[model samples]
Target: MSCKYIYSHVVRLLNESDTICIEFEDAMFGRPKSIRLLREDIVRFMEIREIGARQILVYMGHLYKELKKKDKADYFSFLDPGNIPTCPIGTDDRDLSQHIADQLEAVCRDSICLIPYNTGYHWILTIVNEDKNMIHLLNSTSNRNRDDTWKTIVTNGVKMYNASKGISKGPGFKILTGNLKQSGSVECGYCVMRYMKEIVDCDDPQLEKMFAGCIKNQYYTQCQYDEVRSEWSEFVYSYVGA
Candidate 1:
């Protein structure tokens, strides 16, 4: 988890993964001018590898934070465990374990948390709003009903936290609705990063407007998604270069 290790790993991944390299290039310098460009051509040259560079960008603290203008204590960002060796979210057959409970407690300690959530195939964000005692699901697909498992996880975690603190009464957790949502199927990760920006910017009125617009659109576009990713990628590149 050291910065040096993360920096080196990200650089290697970007250079080795062709699709991500192209995406990083596109984000840094717009699309190629040549009309002859095609997916086949990129595939032939791409150094095919697993796509975890972006995840590394997210977990390694490469993303920038403008601390001069905002309170650092308000937001807590943690990278979620999604791959092998990590236990799956609890289900009827499986109960919530101590390790997962500890993770939840850490997230809930912050006023707002930005953590990744995996749905076996796709990735999404689960935002914990400690102030409101609510868990907001910023899903890209506009599927509200899909957050039941997460809700259970948060609820159980809160209970365990209160017990550990020896508090008989405490604020309970609830799922927040009607917040900003992603527009595309694959844009959830991007939306999560953007949410991190919104939390730090502290522009209440503008944030409200942004959420209202997303609610009206029912979903945003890949363009918006790419824009957020571009910002984060820039931060990652700068950190690596530095």
Candidate 2:
């Protein structure tokens, strides 16, 4: 369906005062997940506002379901931002490592894991490729320092996953900071979502090329942002109905 048609349905729902809820079965987790978006949450898409984790989570869940339906989700998995352990390397790093490793264990070898990491103030994407043993950090903003903590956590998690599979080598980490920057601070979440969609939509061989082809100091166009917003609106309408 066209984005306009889908967005119109969502706008109509927002006009009503009642709570809007979307419930769908999550094939990856073997359970039903319900997402409730209040009117304010829905408004985030309509306006140029900072999207909450709930909105990202909803979109991720929807994307996972859509991919699974088409049998394209076998080589992909998504980690919830809230489930990722925070920084500072606390005393529970081992437990946290194990928790993250457990999640990666479900992912098959030679697969891509999309993670929307929250750096307290902004959202960025961390793409883990087990095939190449590489972690590509895609941030919409120019803040390389903010990614240090997440890089450590995810690298450790990947190490643990390798250990569990009897592999002794660690993964290589690279921070890609040139292109795909958001124009403003509030667009981080939206950019991350669009990045995920782009990566998932690409073929395996084209993945490396896509990252390597990123131009320096480039920003996402308004059309790209609108595309994400449209997709989000369409997903909500498809699941929630009019």
Candidate 3:
């Protein structure tokens, strides 16, 4: 594929059909620090959608660094088919995330779900019909397999932030793990658009400027595109089957 790009007016695809969707902004460089909250967001989004059982978060842009041959894979973080993904560790974190993502893939197998890499940023594929218990299945073996404990599968959102922007922009993508952001959180995307209308968003200008100055890549656009395609298919399938 030539890698299609998104147009200007893209929006989250939300509606009737088979799935629920969620989005997370990156810190320019992908980071896994938001794992707990990202999980919370997924869990909360599913519960609110009343589809907790079926939904799952897809952590994109997992940066696993290359490890030395002497590096022992003894740690839970180390066992990752990917790596722990330090700004230096991401290559290793990549291997770790893939393993977890695969387990997640296997857990949701036969059911409908998608885990894709776009800009190395995190995106989730949630199936509305599935239940919270189903979501639990992916992690069921974690406690048992302590050595290979599966945490959430986080990949890179996009390298656009890291490659194109200067190093000072940093290695992580902007995290909007909540309705609001931390005082110093990098601002970008809808958050900035919302702030521009001056609609009581937040007083912090730091985030607003960050979001305002950020650039988006084809991968994030692709994720949204695929979501729309999936939703449209489900919608048409509903009427056509009738």
Candidate 4:
């Protein structure tokens, strides 16, 4: 009957089956907002496996909505990672470019945007502060040079958004690397998720300092990863019911 017990039960069911475990209306990308996750998708959080796009999208979607409900996301926006392709090709490239532009235009000029970007091999957190025109890349793997592709994708999107709004060209967003904890091979996705949670939990004034000073080059403890796993399981269980 307790929440912890229910979360454990749901996680057990997720590991045991691969059927659709939960469905929710995700309006993160506007129309066609429905999202369905299979048991395997949810189980990734319950295990030590590399999480896929589904897990990132679903978990962030939940966080975004919760922040909105509490009116705590006024100065920030969370983008759906699915809309931004890792290696966009041909017409897909053009479509995704426009999608990013549209999503950017919806947020205010001086606000921050939290983007969860996945390189084919790992997930990294990209924070765009439009006010300062800076892009902060948080890579848990200590590979600072790994964000070149993401820089290209977002730079193009920002240009397209500016052009559509008839704004003059300016020097684009400056990219900087944050000194975040180094993650293991399979922990990148969870690390990104934890980054977002902590970032949003900070007050507006402390946002810059938290990334700049508080979190140094340290690794997440087992208890920290377990905390994320527990939160993720509870989030899924809310939709799955008893």
lDDT of 4 by residue, 1-242 (tens): 23356446656655544444444443444445545677666555566688877787767766766778788756667777776667632223555556777888765455678888887778888787755345677778756464665676666776677777676673254433444564567888888888888877666634456656444557888777776666666666566642
Question: Top model by lDDT, which number?
Answer: 2
Root-mean-square deviation of Cα positions for candidate 4 versus the true structure, in angstroms: 3.8
Q: Supply the global lDDT for candidate 1.
A: 0.45
lDDT string, candidate 3, 1-242, tens digits:
11111111111232223232322223211333222222333323322222111122221211111111223111101111122232221133555445444443333322222222111222111111121122111110112232122222232211221232232232221221222221221212212212222211223323324334323221123334334334323322232212
Provide the lDDT at 79 for model 1.
32
Q: Estimate each model's TM-score.
A: 0.59, 0.84, 0.19, 0.79
Candidate 4 TM-score to native: 0.79
Looking at model 3, residue 132 earns an lDDT score of 13
Q: Put the candidates in lDDT order, highest first.
A: 2, 4, 1, 3
Model 2 lDDT per residue over 88-142, tens place: 5233356666777777775444567887878777888888885637888888876
Q: Backbone clashes per model, in order? A: 2, 0, 64, 0
Stretch of 10 with least lDDT, candidate 3: 1-10
Off by over 4 Å in 4: 1-27, 88-96, 106-110, 130-132, 174-176, 205-208, 213-217
How far does residue 193 in candidate 1 sit from its true spot (Å)? Answer: 2.0
Q: Per-residue lDDT for 72-167 in model 1, tens only?
A: 533444434432122344562124434444655544443455556555555555555554344555555656554666556655555565567675
TM-score preference between candidates 2 and 3, better one: 2
- Candidate 1 vs candidate 3: the TM-score winner is 1
The segments of candidate 1 whose C-alpha lies over 4 angstroms from its true place after superposition are 1-64, 67-97, 104-110, 170-177, 203-216, 239-242
